[model samples]
Target: MAKLLFQRVADEARPPAILGRPGCGPPDYFTEVLLDDLVKSGAWLDLELKRPFLALWVNDEDFDFPDWNDPLIAIDQANVRKFAAMDPVVDLESLRGMRVYHDEPYFR
Candidate 1:
């Protein structure tokens, strides 16, 4: 079940799809600033992911900020095999299992 779900997210988050490109290619920029906005705007739902679990250090007062280190950004095998394959520059394997903390912070 998890494999199928991961594959679905991998398919949806391809750079072209996320960047609204008409053809295959990486985007000119993959910036953390943009990523932060995407997180706060809940744009990742375009990939069908729920709002991510927040980190303990994330200030509740920092409503405008979303931690890039959040598990929502964690790389999995499905992403490595699908989305990450498009970029040769990234060492996707080394990024696996990088969650610094585990456990959901807030209840929806």
Candidate 2:
């Protein structure tokens, strides 16, 4: 199963009413519950400590922002830096050839 996610700082910019709150809704019932469990078990935080940064690139146009790649890319970089800061195990300098993607335009 997969889900589209954005880090807190990126999602909360100017208060994202679109992303809404996380929970078990009709469209993402399974992923929602799994995420809740992960939160309770501190799995995501642990992953930040042990794994490379997880990034899912989403088109800004689909999210109601026009030509927002620059800002989105900036957010991606910030997420990596912030995560590295929070977890000593994250080696940003050692991560090479890593990239943020430009997902094909998402359609409703």
Candidate 3:
């Protein structure tokens, strides 16, 4: 499943984005949940590691995930950009932090 999500994100050439506040609650599991959803939907895109913010991009520009708006996700887009700029090779690290889980089986 992790490989599939990575492949989808790499193939799509879009980075997965994540957002979170400083010292927030437990490592939010939303990213993992969303990753499962994206893979199931066959829309998993690239993973973007912007330090405080990690994001997942779908093929569509307006694609919206309820998780994106979660307060646990980052609230400031600038912070995300800062992280991205600081480390261009952010995806590699982001992928490592991701914890793939076994949820409802997804079929495409």
Any residue pairs clashing in model 2, and if so which? none
- Estimate candidate 3's alpha-carbon lDDT, on a 0 to 1 scale: 0.35
Error of 2 at 33 (Å): 17
What is the descending TM-score order? 2, 3, 1
- Poorest lDDT segment (10 consecutive residues) of candidate 3: 44-53
Q: What's the lDDT for all of these models?
A: 0.30, 0.36, 0.35
User: Over the stretch 1-108, how does candidate 2's per-residue lDDT look in tens digits?
Assistant: 333333332233232222324443544333223333333333335443123233321222232233446764454445444544553345544444445432222222
Residues 1-60 of candidate 3 have per-residue lDDT tens digits of 253433333335333423222343444444444443333344322233222224332211
What TM value does model 1 have?
A: 0.21
Could you tell me how far off, in angstroms, the CA of residue 87 lies in candidate 3 after the best superposition? 2.4
TM-scores of the candidates are 0.21, 0.32, 0.23
Candidate 3 has a TM-score of 0.23
Regions of model 2 farther than 4 Å from truth? 1-44, 47-50, 54-69, 97-108
